[model samples]
Target chain A: MIRTLPCSAAYTNGFRLYMVLFYIFLIMPLVTICILAFNDSNYIALPWNGFSLDWFFANTNERLGLFKDEGLMLSVWTSLETGFFVALFSTIIGTIAALLFEEEQFRMKGFLYFLALAPLVIPGVVLGISILLSSTYAGTYLEENLGMSFEFLGPSFWLVVIGQFSFGATYVMLLVGARLKKFDRVLEEAALSLRATRLEVIWLITIPFLRPAIIGAFIVAFLISFSNFNTTIFLVGSDPTLPVDLYSRIKFSSTPVLNAVSFMIVVFISFAAMISYVINRKKT
Target chain B: MKKNKSSTFFLLMVPVLLWLVLLIVIPHLDMFFRSFRFENDEGLMVFSLNNYLSFFEDKIYWLTFVKTALYSIGVTILAFIVTFPVAFFLTKVVAKKYSSFMVLLLLIPIWIGELVTIYGWMILLSDNGVINNFLMQIGLIDSPIVMLYTNFSMTIGLLYMSMLFMIIPMMSALESLDDSLIEAASDLGASKWTIFRQIIIPYTTPGIASGGIIVFMLVIGDYVAPNILGGKSSLWFTEQIYNKFLATFNWNEGAAFGFLLLLLSSGIIWLALKLTGQKLEKVGS
Candidate 1:
């Protein structure tokens, strides 16, 4: 569909130039940070003093690398732990929601679907606050009324997972639901006609068909939880997630090592995204 | 058999519905009421509209609230303008094979995370940042200019941070458009500008509306870009809510502000949707 319109060559040239400049505008910052990660300078800023991996592996006073930094590493551990749990729970619950919507006779489907997506539009800060307040209120009520105490809701690790899952699940639902919409109903019916149980039909035919979307949803949920700061900051207990830790650290005492961490994360996520892209392309 | 099917359906829906009701809806309802309740000077709980009143009475709070709203709206429009052409070029101008790769370039920044992306912007726009340094090296300026911590920097950060949200929707909208319509218009001897305004713009209204909603909401809700990129001068509404909750420990006030922020963003989005004749259900999808 190349344009056969009476467009001038100058217009095409200008459009190409604009595209190149826009790409630079979009990418220059990340590229700069990546390049600066290896800078040998003590400052986080410029004057790139030759490429050095000191920021990543250096273990000494004033310049401990990301891996060696105890607090930072702990935050990284907590984030990974939270991300895993969040992804697992969100995928299971979200997949169920998608499947539920697939039923033609499902009651209140429209309203329930909207309710499912409510969290997606809510601000992360508000979501975090509401969840924290409600959980703490519930925790106190249990302690006073039921004479039992629960530590899980009071700025604990599980709170972070729950807070993240509240919204992350919506993402999973959308992804799986989108895939489910295009699925053929005949396969499920054919399997059922062959005396396959509902569970068996879903296990063999439906699950296999939805594998790519389910896996993709899991990865997306994991990444969202991993990088989420706006919501997670409030829900985080004494152990901050990687983004929270990086945020506070960047605010007070930023080092080149943070850039290194960013570089590594970018690489990891880019790899994940590329794999998903390939999978999706292959599916079609 | 019908009963069994309904039961299975119920079983499948119960967990997700319970999750949404217990975690999402109930908490929000609880917070909405909590916002109306304030603690008195005697340290006793009292229900009043004082928290919301205080938001209106305080000049800084109300002014900052308005400014944040304007900035968010401004960013949304700016982002739409900046990315519309790019999206059009990618979806319509570029060869189909190369467009996906072009879009992939946009995803890299997003994958890098907001904090890291803002950090990149900080390095690029700070006093001794790459931009200033480059300018100095070229003898364009005598010394570094303070680009960071300004409203300009904040807008740039917000625009860059949420560019993908705007781009993805617009690209999808534009891609779904029938190229034959454009060909027909051109063959009818209509100019490119006229075809774009009359044919293309009307078609992508829903996409534009959805993009505006996402970008405005995300920008207004964002704390990282404003805190880091806008620096000390930044008085983002989210930061105010944060301070009320964390620093002041005024949960009631924080809750009120939180709800206010939520309502303000949602109200604007609702109005925009109404004006554009788009539906909420369509916007979310």
Candidate 2:
């Protein structure tokens, strides 16, 4: 018989045990938060009271649940709105950029590509500050020189979208670009040779080829914009995204409702992830 | 036809080029200019190096900057050591079908909101937190150990935050290795350690480099874990930048510090690339 490998049965069993423990360490925190969310204890920690939904549904003078908390709900609404606008704008511009980069010959293409990728490498905090300062300066110039003012131009809802879209677009471009790399350009040329106009070829062949990537990029961008905190924190004006609101609430005065909100978000994201995993698993 | 194609390319490029210019390039340029100027007594903007000089003059600023860089580097190495085995185990030991499930399990924490993840850690590691309470109930100690607000807690949180970034790349790298190569080495009478060192480590260098770069950059630039878990003991560089901009309203100082951070991170990335001999394009993708 062939010699057994260096790792004995005991060694393999030990390694397997270690892997299980490591996975537990990776998952324990989120599991704890989920459990504590429904705990009847007013405090967020252990010593869980009887199972109750007060954190999710209760509204009283002392304890306000996630559903009844107006400020928290409003922030959630703002985050969804920001995610929508950022996702839409980033998807369009990023897809264009991806298609443009596929062209064989172009001037300054390398430099432009580098610039496009710069946002990915830069720290989000710095990106936020730079965007905020530049927009502030632009707003001042318009007010002083042109005798005009636009409320949307400042640090408001639109600015948050712009700030998030700055990097979100980069992500979309990368995703779409990866997809385009695998595309068969011969299909486009074949369509064009068949008396199909360029626009017709693109609409029929190219866009359909890119549909999966575009949809994937949109969802990815939306999730990123919704969860973004470092960049949006600086750019948010009167209204905060869910993350920023949760951050401030945690910093100052927090309740178990915060845990409830976290629980809801975790469940939603996990469900979305499971769906995407199923879809991708099916495709593969 | 060539001319038409070139013109069409230009038209397609314009929107994205404009977006990058108006938002990214121009804003960074604005920041660069802002970093170099200060308002005078006469309310006139004057170009000076004082903003940069202040960074040099203050011992705390530079010290904290160096400490943050070192701490992040330490975390990067620690994360690599911790995750490499997990990555290896997943790719080498587990069945193929279950590996994806394992990856998805690890990914849940990453895709969850960062703030919520941190809050989870806060509950676990705080003074009267889960671990402490459990330990006390077991008669390990009479009082809760000061787990939170220490450098230990900050590093733990940072490592947790960085787990997925480190693990994903390592898994991908290890997955690409040919199993037969290891089998061949084993058949040649090589010990497992020798095969791992001679073949696996050398082969996965690119993945290691990329993962290391991503993890180091993230840990260094992060403001959340350091602030929430680090408390007063951890003087993270991003916290300094935040204070300068938001607390002091000193945009000039903040801009200078921000550029410095950018420079430090980029410099380290360049060194990593050089040392690993991996192209930016290959590692980035």
Give a tens-digit lDDT track for model 2, residues A66-136: 99999999999999999999999999998888888774567788888888887766888889899988998
DockQ of 1: 0.65
lDDT digits (tens) for residues A1-284 of candidate 1: 23555578888888889899999998888888889988988888897789888888889787888778888889888989999999999999999888887744556778888888877678899999999889999999999999999888798899999999999999898899889988999999999899987778777888899998999899889988988989988888888899999999889998898888888887787787787678767876
Q: Is the docking of candidate 2 incorrect, acceptable, medium or high quality?
A: medium
Model 2 lDDT, full chain set:
0.86
lDDT of 2 by residue, B1-285 (tens): 375564456667779878999999999998988999888889888998999999999999999999998999999999988888888888888778998888888878877867888889899987777888889899999988998888998998899987678887787888888887887888889887898789989999988988988888788888888988887868899999999987999998899999899889889888998988986666556
Q: Interface RMSD, all models, one decimal each? A: 1.7, 3.0
Report the TM-score of chain B alone for all candidates: 0.96, 0.96
True contacts kept of each: 0.57, 0.47
What TM value does chain A in model 2 reach? 0.95
